[model samples]
Target chain A: MHEMSLCENILQTLQQQANAQQYSKVKTIWLEIGELAGVEADALRFSFDSVMQDSIADQARLEIIDIAGQAYCSHCAKNVPIQQRYDACPECGHFPLQIVAGDQMRIKQLEVE
Target chain B: MCGICGCGEGHTHSHEEDHSHDSLDHDHHNPIDGHQHAAQHTHAQGLSPARMVQIEQDILAKNNAYADENRRYLSQRGILALNLVSSPGSGKTSLLTETIKRLKEELSIAVIEGDQQTTRDAERIRATGVPALQINTGKGCHLDAHRVGHAFEHLALSDHSLLFIENVGNLVCPSAFDLGEAHKVVILSVTEGEDKPIKYPDMFHAADLMILNKTDLLPYLDFNSAECIAYAKRVNPKIKVLSLSAKTGEGMDNWLKWLKAELELQRIDYA
Candidate 1:
């Protein structure tokens, strides 16, 4: 699964940050997985636990904040929550809308001691 | 009962008064019984309430940075990279072989073949007399931007070049990661049925082009090309659909024409 690879990237970033800050232990890791990012939260968490065992993030709690997909309706000129990419705007029934947010994967913050 | 320190021992261990554990009384089990120990264990082993709210980050930010670097590199080189995604035995290699044979004379083409094992696809492309590199993913389901960056090091890509990244034979996981491709082409064979686009809409939705491969087999199979195109359009209206048989060279003219046009456009943009 790509979740494993994603977890590896997370661990790499966490390690870099920890090394830079000289943090002895990481208490928690905050992640924002977007709805259209195509990453499963449960699968990522499972893979993170397995991959982080020998790393700086060992025993670190993974906090996933799932962001809902949002689209800017070109026709309606309104922002709307998008469940799927091809979904018509709830207000104006537009066919093609520009995705404004919720297609992202980012590390927001890290709690460390 | 000093609240400043979670004092189990007599010595006061207080240092930072700013760090205080927020007590929410998350006791799910009987607090009176010794079973509270079991509940505490569950809470500690699982997600801590305090730890949950503090972290709100995207885990793939690092990968996204690498992907952005790859995009910059490809754009600087003026290379139109295409990531071809499909299931195994979907004739991706055959389609690439045909495309190379048709376009090799007119264009500077290079290929990066991704497979779980073996350099079979790379060898196939090399047979067409073009520079090719094989990336054995080694249990990886999809090729990421970093792996692609590594592959790009081996290829001699110049301005106005065409680079094709034949992703690992998977429709699901490969659709998730962007390999710094200018366009993503999802190929569906006629033998896979018309419902494939609907079943794997993520791949269809992510793709810029939908290639309906193996039209010669359509007579024996129950695939309706029109319905397949309709389904793909429903998911992604902007996606261009082309039906072609890589085997018999049927409808290949249109495929080659599209490539030529894209290459010309890219050359102009680069200039």
Candidate 2:
């Protein structure tokens, strides 16, 4: 799975932040993963522990924040919730809704010393 | 393969320990009266308490940076680079071989083949009298921008040439990583399930064009071409589509025309 790659990316971000923030130890990490990001939270959590071993974030706890998919329905002229990319507009039953959010993977914040 | 850096072939998280912990002796000092009396400073007084640092950084920022560099590199030289993605056994290699055979006589064609192992695809492309390079990703599912940038160093690409990057045969992971291509052409054979577009919407959504290959085999199969196209359009309203068979040269003229038009457009935009 690509979750391993995403985990490595998370560790690299942590290292870069450690340099700028001067935090020798990272206690907990808060990751924001979107619904359409195609990342499984369980797989990411399983890889996070091994990926962070022996690094500054060793033994750190991972906190994943789930984000719901949001889109703008041009047919209905309103914002609607979409669980997937091909989801039709709930109000007008139209295809091709412009995606507004919930397709991003970002490191929101970290608790460190 | 190392997914983040693409350094080693089939290498895991194995490395020599280099982290030193020589700066964690907070039990010996007392800031109040300069006395090590009871060895009991549960919370270090002078040290700042743990705080939350705000870092709203995109996870794919690094990959995107590399992709941008590649885009600039290709644009400056007026190169028409296309990233072809598909599932296994989708006739991507056959399509490339056929396309190269048709265009190599008039243009400089090059290919970069990606697979977990083996150089057969590259060999096949090279047999068409064109330069080709094979990248063995060994256990890696997708090719990132960093590895593709590294591949550019070895390829003696000329100005105004066509470069095709055949991504690893996977419909899932490769959609997320942009390799600085002018367009992503996803090849879907009719042998696969018709519901693939709905099942793997992310890939179809990221693609600029979808090629419905193996039209010759449509007579024997129960695959409905109209429904498949509709499903793809449902996911990506702007994605251009072409139906072709890379073997019998059926509907290939449309694909070649599209490529030539895109190359001409790139030249005009760069000029």
Candidate 3:
């Protein structure tokens, strides 16, 4: 929902890491986005170019890694795959499950010069 | 848990240019500063090879850090801060004022009201004789933890008090940003569609409690209370629901009771 601000966050991180990692320009950024992370990939891509304008990572290509959602359903006593945050256990019709994975929105890697 | 995490609110990235990159060959202005020229090398073509740098950091890590600081500050003092989130016109202000009016005499009550461009909610809160501070987010869709941290420094929050943060009338963005609140209470008025829980399932799923406000008009409208709670539970089975009419003062005792219980829990957690 706040993709523009998120892009700005990426820019900030790129600038910070530039000092620590010693990179002048960012060629690409690989982000690991999970299904339940509540970020729209299209919106993020649309905002990336505008938010990174004239910055260190300006015109950087975005690579998104899709991660499916997984949760531990106690009723089934196993981790199950799910698409939505409110999804019941696919195996046992459990109303709620402990989210075990796929809630991440992270910057996994960056290609720099 | 670093206390300095919230210092970014006043930070300027101008220091980024001051860092002496190894490519300090430029007499004054360095154009290729963004590209980390880590190795001091003389490339024949003046081009650096592209290489992968692993970051593996959460996008919201900075904000989460600030939230952690705020949470530590509040929890250490035995304060119970609740983030009230909902779509526009969910009676969040009314419920807040009513909640304050009921408990102001017994507890130290304070408020932080967030809106796009108005202090009116804060004014309403202050009219109840409780201290209130207003945060104008301007174009922001929600209140972040950094701003909440600043507000915390300004407000005179005594120990073992109740802090109510009325977030900007947004259900989507606020669900993602934690403002160091003890719990997120999503309020949905019957006047709005009951299908909200399913329509915005992320908010429903993130909220620990769901307040079904404006139940006083339940008889006037065809608002089905049963289905609404069912949908909320379907979305979040552990979510607790409390039906109340903030305007009519009905079902407020249960709300107050819940507050006291949470305050007690906060005390136990602190001890």
Candidate 4:
């Protein structure tokens, strides 16, 4: 799964932060994954432990923050919560909503030693 | 703002920005005792005093760095790079071979074929008398910008050339990794279900152009062309669609024209 590669990216970020923050080990990581980011949290969790093996963040707890999907409705001219990319506007029922937010995959913060 | 790490709320960084060790000053906070010996140190509730470090960085930052580098390199040389993505048996290799055969004489063309383990695609492209590099991902599902950048070096692409990066035969993972291409051209064969757009929304949404390949087989299949287009439009309103068959060269002119338009656009921007 691509979640393996995503976890590798997370591990790299953790290593960089560990060096910058002068921490020998990481306790927990808070990853902000949006609902529309196309990343499966379960897949990421499954690959996290193996990907973090022998790294500075070995055995670090991965706490994912699920961000809600949001889109800008052109018809309604309002921001609406959407579950899928092709979701219509909740109010106007218009198709092809412009995505304004909730498609980000970012490392928010880390709980480290 | 803090005298320790220079990381504040307003701090913004590019993908290529090097984040060196900031060397946090632990001298004031018990030095070795603060940095180490944290496993044994517990708070009032027996909770580890784990410090929270704010790092609002994109997870794709590393891959984006390589992608940015590739974009610059290609743009500087006026190379029109397109990433071709599709599922297995979508005739991505056949499309490239056919395209190269048609365009290699008029324009400098090269290809980078990606697969889990196969040089066959690259060999096929090379058989068309165009330079092709095979990137065997070796269990990797997608080609990252880093690997593409490395492949670019070996390709020795000419100025104002066309580079096609035929990604691994998977619709899901390749949509996420940006290989520094000018555009991502996703090819969907008619033999596949017409509801593929909705089934793989991420790929369709990320794609700039969707090529409905193998249109020659439409007569025998139940694939609804209009419905497929409609589904694709639902996810990406701005996505351009073109139906073509790499085998019989049906609607190849339109595909070639699209390539020419992109090349011309790249030249204009370079100018």
Q: Highest DockQ, which number?
A: 3
Going through the candidates in order, their DockQ values are 0.22, 0.48, 0.53, 0.45
lDDT of 2 by residue, B50-107 (tens): 7788989988777787788888888888889999999999999999999999998888
Question: What residue pairs are clashing in model 2?
Answer: B1-B10
Q: Is candidate 1 or candidate 3 better by lDDT?
A: 3
- Taking every candidate in turn, the Cα RMSD to the unseen true structure, in Å, is 15.0, 9.7, 7.6, 9.5
Return whichever of 1 and 2 wins on lDDT: 2
Query: What fraction of the native alpha-carbon contacts across the interface, defined at 8 angstroms, is recovered by model 1?
Result: 0.45
Order of models, best DockQ first: 3, 2, 4, 1
TM-score of each: 0.78, 0.87, 0.86, 0.87
**Lowest lDDT 10-residue stretch of candidate 3 chain A:** A1-10
Q: How close is candidate 2 to the true structure, as a TM-score?
A: 0.87
Candidate 4 lDDT over residue span B1-271, tens digit each: 2222223235332321253111111112111222332243344576656688899999988778778878988998899999999999999999888888889889999888888885788888889998888777777898888767756756779999999998999989999999889999999999999999999999999999999999999999999999999999999998999999999999999999999999988886633
Off by over 4 Å in 3: A74-77, A89-94, B5-48, B269-271
lDDT of 4: 0.83
Q: Going through the candidates in order, what fraction of the true interface contacts does each contain?
A: 0.45, 0.67, 0.68, 0.74
The digit string of per-residue lDDT tens for model 1 on B1-271 reads: 2121122235321321135211111112111121111112223455643332233345655556657777777777677888999999889999999999888887889998888887778888999999888777777898877667656755758778899999999988888787778889999999998888767778988999889999999889878889988888877879998889999999999988887776666554443
DockQ of 2: 0.48
User: Which digits, one per residue and each the tens of the lDDT, describe model 3 over residues B161-242?
Assistant: 9999988898888888889999999999999978889888889988999999998899899888899888888878899999
Give the residue spans of candidate 2 off by over 4 A: B1-49, B269-271
What TM value does model 4 have?
Answer: 0.87
Tens digits of per-residue lDDT for model 3, A1-113 = 57866776677778778878867788999999999988899999998999787787888999999999999988888899999877888888986788888989999999987
DockQ-derived CAPRI band for the predicted complex in model 4: acceptable
Q: What's model 1's lDDT at A25?
A: 57
